[model samples]
Target: MIRVVILGAGNIAQHLYTVFTKSEAIQVVQVYNRSQKALQSFTNVATTTRLKELRDADVYIIAVADDAIASVANKLPFTNRLVVHTSGSASMHVLHKKNRRGVFYPLQTFTKGKEVDFSQIPLCLEAREKTDFKVLQQLADAIGSPSYKISSEQRRALHVSAVFVNNFSNHLYRIAHEICEANNVPFQILHPLIQETAHKITTLTPYMAQTGPAKRGDQKTIDDHLEKLDKDIHKEIYTLLTQSIAKTYGREKL
Candidate 1:
């Protein structure tokens, strides 16, 4: 069995802990956080607020924030064990070399109370050593997650793409919701379109899935949208995206 000690109590930490516990091949020996209060939810497993009291384990998964990763790894009392972080933007080198470093980035946005299917999340794995990479793969396999062997450089590129697809797109949804609220329209009315847009990418490339006034270079419709928007920020975003879509389709004006 692979023993893992998760070192944070945040969203990623909680989700990883939940999935790891449900796997028969992996055992969460202990959970460590800066304070005991956050560790309250991990009742069945051993937990500590102090690093010095950490138990020896096969893997130490540092599921903390990007800035705090090095601090936690540097403070660890042990060395040469497999140490990995659950960050997409941060490089694996962020983990102190005192321990073998790896990355276990799950390419999905995690929320505190949301329960996601572990099998649906892809695990982005990177390690300094080939053996360490295998260990991470084993952990991924235990959770039934599809694993990818991504180098740090490739992982960095992937992370940026993820931001564009996940983060930026989510922000657009927020903007749409705000517009809906201002117009006194039910946001749920747009839910089907949102779901269809997401599903279209499964069979068609985004470039091929394009369909809108901007894609058709309908300047009148574009102007109408800009004029309808009440906020300057929303107008700016609309214009920018319209320009982008037009440019993608080789349309000089929209």
Candidate 2:
């Protein structure tokens, strides 16, 4: 069994602790954070605040913020034991050179206080050495996850694409919410449409599934939508995106 010492007590840490603890092929030997108070959420596992007190383990998984990773890695008591960080945007080189470095970043949006479905999330693995890569892959498989061997360059591309899918998509939902509020319509009415929009991409390419007043070249409808938006900034954004989408479909006027 691969023993893992997780370094962090945040959302990703909690999720990984839960999943890894339940896996038969791996064991969570310890969980460490800078503050002892934050470790209360973990039960039946050794928790510590001092990095010097970290126990021997097959791997030390740093699941902390981007800025704090190096600080934590620098404090590890031993060198050359596998050390990995679970960050999508941060590079693997950020970790201290004292150990076998790798990135075990999970590509997905994490919300505190909400349960995450790890089975649906993709794990991106990167290692400085081949042996470390196999170790990371073994852990991923133990937790019933699909993983991809990605270089720092490909991971950067994935991170940027994720921002467009998760961050930008959430902003669009906020805009939709505001529009619903202005029309005295409950935002719940859009829930089905929003769900369907995401579901459509599973079976159809986004380009082929695109549909709107703009796609149909309905200039009158496009103008009405812009006028209905209460905020000028939102109207501007809507107009720009609509125009861009229309142009892609050879209906530039809309």
Candidate 3:
């Protein structure tokens, strides 16, 4: 069995630990964090607050915040052992040269206290060495997820695109929620539409599925949407994005 060590006790770390421990080909030998209290959920698995106490695992995965990754990686006592981080925005080089560095970024937003389906998440793998790349790919397969090899440059692009799709999309949801509250309409009314919008993209590209008054250059409706916005910033953002979408589809008038 491939012995594994997991760093951090956050949402992503917890999810990965749970999944890795269940894999037959892998065994979570130890879990380390600066605070022992954060490692509470890892019952039956060895836990430590000291880096030196971390055992001789085949691979060490740093699943902490982007800022804390380098600090943890730097403390590893071994050289040439596989070390990987689960960050989408952080570069693979952040890991100390004392160990082989790689990235096992799962391209999905993770929220604490909620369960995530690994099967739906795409694992982006990158390593300077081919052997390390295969190791990451094997790990993704062991966990029953799809894995893609991406360069730091391509990964950066994907990370930025993810911010647009996930972060910006969530903000749009919040805006819709507020609009519903102001109009005394239930937000649940938009649930079906939201699901359908996401479902449509599975079969149709966002460019092909694009719709609305903005795409059609309906100046009347565009003006009405902007006038309905309670906040000036929201109106500005909406207008900018609408204009961008219009330009993308060759509808320059919007």
The numbered model that scores best in TM-score is: 1
- For model 1, the stretches where C-alpha displacement exceeds 4 angstroms are none
Error of 2 at 52 (Å): 0.6
| Ranking of models by lDDT | 1, 2, 3
- On lDDT, the stronger of 1 and 2 is 1
Residue-pair clash count for candidate 1:
0
TM-score of 1: 0.98
Candidate 1, residues 37-150: lDDT per residue as tens digits? 999998799999999999989899999888999999899998899999988888889888889999999999999999999999999999998999999999999999999998
Candidate 2 global CA lDDT score: 0.91
Q: Would you estimate the TM-scores of all the predictions? A: 0.98, 0.95, 0.96
Query: Which is the better candidate, 1 or 3, if ranked by lDDT?
Result: 1
- Pairwise TM-score winner, candidates 2 and 3: 3
Question: Lowest lDDT 10-mer window, candidate 2?
Answer: 112-121
Question: What are the per-residue Cα lDDT tens digits for candidate 3 across 91-175?
Answer: 9999999889999899988888788888898999998889888888888989889999887788999999999999999999999
**Worst 10 contiguous positions by lDDT, candidate 1:** 245-254
Which stretches in model 2 have alpha-carbon errors above 4 Å? Answer: none
